[model samples]
Target: MSEKRDMSRSRKLFITDKLMRLLLVGAASTSVLVVCLIFLFLFREAGPFALNPGLGKLLDSQWIPVSFQEEHFGVGPLLAGSALVTALAMLVTVPISVLVSIYIAEIAHPTEREFLKPFIEILASIPSVVLGFFGLLVVAPLIKTTFGLSTGLTALTGALLLSLMAIPTIISLSEDALVSVPYALKNASLALGASHLQTIFRVTLPAALPGIVAAVMLGIGRVIGETMAVLMVTGNSAILTASPLSSVRTMTATIAAEMGEVPFGSVHYQALFWIGIILLVITFFLNIIAQRVLKKYGMMK
Candidate 1:
């Protein structure tokens, strides 16, 4: 009777394990399907962008999409705007976030770290639209007054706002990476007559490099995809300018500002989808690089 009972229990557990495995596989498959569908849809809408609008126009700086006579879909301005804002934002976000993470992970007392972590998370939880409003009302005026500019809506303003948004992400992930560095390694460095700061810079930070790189990439990705905040404060001008003080419109901003008013199935509409495809490709590459670094570090299989 006991032997029969044991055999029955084993059979039931095996069946349950198989059922759970199938459910996990199905969920993962569904996620992949959703992503593929999105890519396909964007590609379908953007197919005519090349032929009708002509890829030749992309090299031109003029982007008069809604002009009365001869509308041009020059993408140079949008790409430049995005690159400038994203680069500037990353320049500000990376150093500040990494420094703060290092302080939190290595220097701060436990209670202080506990207090700071919650604030970082809270900042992250704040909605993008609210930040947009703050930038529009507060930061914009400050920039305009300080720079003696006609208006405050410029690439610098958008980059500052985006940096504010990206900081929490970079800090939280980087703090975790820094903290994950083994205590034994630090002890060994200390025993070798190295000071705390030296050990951190030479040993801990290097060991945490992969994770830090991943965090920075993710932060850059966030800055690239941001639309509402940049749209609200960037003056929405699609102009080719190298100056950070100049008003500009990013690809995401262009899509947000124009998509609703644009007529569906028009060449202009497909052009917006093409912008989405560009953003999708950039973000995809960033994620791939991040994952590769993590995998090399044995953080992922």
Candidate 2:
């Protein structure tokens, strides 16, 4: 009787485990399906412009989609603007985030780490719109006054705000990666008479390099996708310029600022979808690269 009872209990547990596994698989599969569906929908809507966009139209500096004379769908300015802002944001964010991460992971006391971690997380939780408001009201004026510019709204303004948003993500992920470095490696470095700083730069950082790369890539993704803040502060200009101080319009800002006014199924509307496709592709690549780095580091299977 006892043997039969144990066997029955084991069988029930096995069935429960199998059910849970199936549920998990289903959830993952659903997520993948949803992503593919989104790609299909975007491509379907943007197909007309995306498939046969004229050479000059796509590469033109102007982006006047509402003009009565000629509706241009050039994305050169938008792409350039996105790239400029993202580059500046990454420049400001990556180094500071990595340094802060190293300090939190290796140098800070446990109490300091505890306080800092939550504070960084809180920064990450702040809404983008609020940051946009802050940028418009505060940072914009400061930049104008300090730089002696005619207006405060420029790619630099957007980059500054986006950097603020990207920093928390970079710091948190990078700190985790640094923390995950094996203690044995650190100990061995110390046994070889390496100083703490030396050990960190030579051994710990190298071990955590993959995670750091992932962190930077994810931060780039955050900066690239930001809309409200960039729209509010970038002056919404579609000018093609390499200067960070110039007013610019990012792809995200373009979509946010114009999507509502565009008639549904219009060429302008479809052009917006094309922009979405571009953004989706950029973000997808960033995620793929980050995942590859993580997998290489054994952080993912």
Candidate 3:
């Protein structure tokens, strides 16, 4: 009787553990389902825009959705503008953020690093609207004056603000990567007559390459998806141009700016959904690339 009772108790514990695991898996699967549902709905609505031949005009520099009367459905300009702004922001952000991360992780005194880290994280906690407001009031005017921009809002203005926003995330993630570098490896590099900087570049960074890549990818995703601040500062012109000083519109801005006014089932409304699809695709690719890079570099281990 005693042995039978013990076995029953053991089976109950096993069942409980399996049940918990099943619940966790179900939760994750449900979350993925929700995401897939969103993608499906976006595409369903965007089908008209995708099917329209006027998509060519939407890519054109001039976006007078009303002037032509016949209607136009161009997305190329918005897509290109968003890409350019995000690229510029990444250019400005990645180096500064990585360097800062290195300083905090590998060089700074513990007390000072601890004190500063939270402040950096606080930047991420700030709402997007506040950042947009800051850009409108402060950065936009500064850009107008310093660069002679006709309008305070331009691609450069948005890029600058977005770069600032990207910094906290990049710094936080890169610092974690730097911290994860094996101490023995650092010591070995130093023992071989390598200076701290050389050791960092040669040994520590390479080992943490995956995490750094992940950090940059995440930053790109943030910049590409950012709506409020970019909408406020990117001039929202929906015109494609090479000049950073000129006004531009990003995919996110187009949806945010136009969706409300566009009548339901209208071509323009469908086009906005297409823009969402594009944004989703861009983000998905970035994440997949980051994952592949991490795996290739053995960082996942």
lDDT of the candidates, in the order given: 0.92, 0.91, 0.87
Q: Model 1 over residues 19-124: C-alpha lDDT tens digits?
A: 9999999998998999999999999988877886676766666888888788888788899999999998998999999999999999999999889999888989
Candidate 1 lDDT trough over 10 residues, lowest sum = 52-61
Model 3 residue-pair collision total: 2
For model 3, the local distance difference test gives 0.87
* Model 3 stretches astray by more than 4 angstroms: 1-24, 51-62
In candidate 2, what are the lDDT values of residues 110-139, reduced to their tens digit? Answer: 999889899988888899999999999999
- TM per candidate comes to 0.92, 0.90, 0.89
Clashing pairs in 2: none
Q: What CA RMSD would candidate 3 show? A: 2.9
Would you list the rank order by lDDT, best first?
1, 2, 3
Clashes of each: 0, 0, 2
Q: How displaced is residue 100 in candidate 2, in Å?
A: 0.3
- Superposition error at 125 for model 3 (Å): 0.8
Query: Cα-based RMSD of the predictions, in order?
Result: 2.7, 3.2, 2.9
